[model samples]
Target: MTIKLLAIGKTDNKLLASLITDYQNRLGHYIKFEFEIIPDLKKVKHLSETQQKEKEGALILSKLAATDTLILLDEKGKQMHSIAFSEYLQKYMNSGIKQLVFVIGGPYGFSEAVYNKAQGMLSLSKMTFSHQMIRLFIVEQFYRAFTILKNEPYHHR
Candidate 1:
């Protein structure tokens, strides 16, 4: 299955962008991966948090394919260790999905509609992380998970 990561907004930090690129390149060897960045909403000062979430939610939904399996990287989602996460990836690959999309929502988080559309949710950590940083973290984890699955030395117990 092809894996896609959809995140709202651009990564402004040069260092973070480079790191994300590095991991993206590494992840490509194991699976088809695409990282799509939705442009940040403009004039956010005029919109309330709810309005922003609703607008962002619509944009997020627009990027999804009807048959895609959506998974949100949410704070309240299920948290798993590295090995378990690797197993989760194995399960998804075995499920014969067309595409697996993992989304990192806007600053305020996902709207109810986005939540309802998701097949599942995953939490990388209990602690909060910036949206840009999460991109790198998730990509790196994808690489690590693949390495683990292949019995490579890139990941250790």
Candidate 2:
């Protein structure tokens, strides 16, 4: 199965971008992984929070295909250990999922329509992290999970 990460906005911090790239490269060794950035909303100063989220949600939804299994990185979602996450991915692959897409919403989070379209939601942690940082973290975790599944030295139990 192919794993895709879709997030809102760019990672402006050079250091963070480098780290995200590093993980992305490592993850490529184990799976077909792709990270796509959805540009930030324009003229946000005039739009209400709800309006901004609605606009962003539409853009996010538009990037998806009808066959894609949409998952959201939501704070209230399920939290799993690295090993378990690997197993979860294994199950998806076993079930023959073509593409698994995980999305990180914009500043005010996803709109109701986006939430409704998601098949599942996952949380990296209970504490909050910047959306850009979360992208890096999730990429790294995907790499670690694959390493764990393969019994590679990259991940230690």
On TM-score, the candidate that comes out on top is 1
Point out the worst 10-residue segment of candidate 2 by lDDT. 88-97
Model 2 superposed RMSD (Cα): 0.7
Residue 31 in candidate 2 has what lDDT? 93
Tens digit of per-residue lDDT, candidate 2, span 1-157: 8999999999999999999999999988999999999999888999999999999999999999999999899998999999999998888888888999999999899999999999999999999999989998999989998988899998788
lDDT against the true structure, each candidate:
0.96, 0.94
Q: Report RMSD (Å) for each prediction in the order shown.
A: 0.6, 0.7
Q: Which ten residues in a row have the lowest lDDT in candidate 1?
A: 80-89
Error of 2 at 61 (Å): 0.5
Clashes of 1: 0
TM-score of each: 0.98, 0.98
Cα misplacement distance, residue 34 of candidate 2 (Å)? 0.8
- Write the residue-wise lDDT of candidate 1 on 1-157 in tens digits: 9999999999999999999999999888999999999999999999999999999999999999999999999999999988899999999999999999999999999999999999999999999999999999999999999999999999878
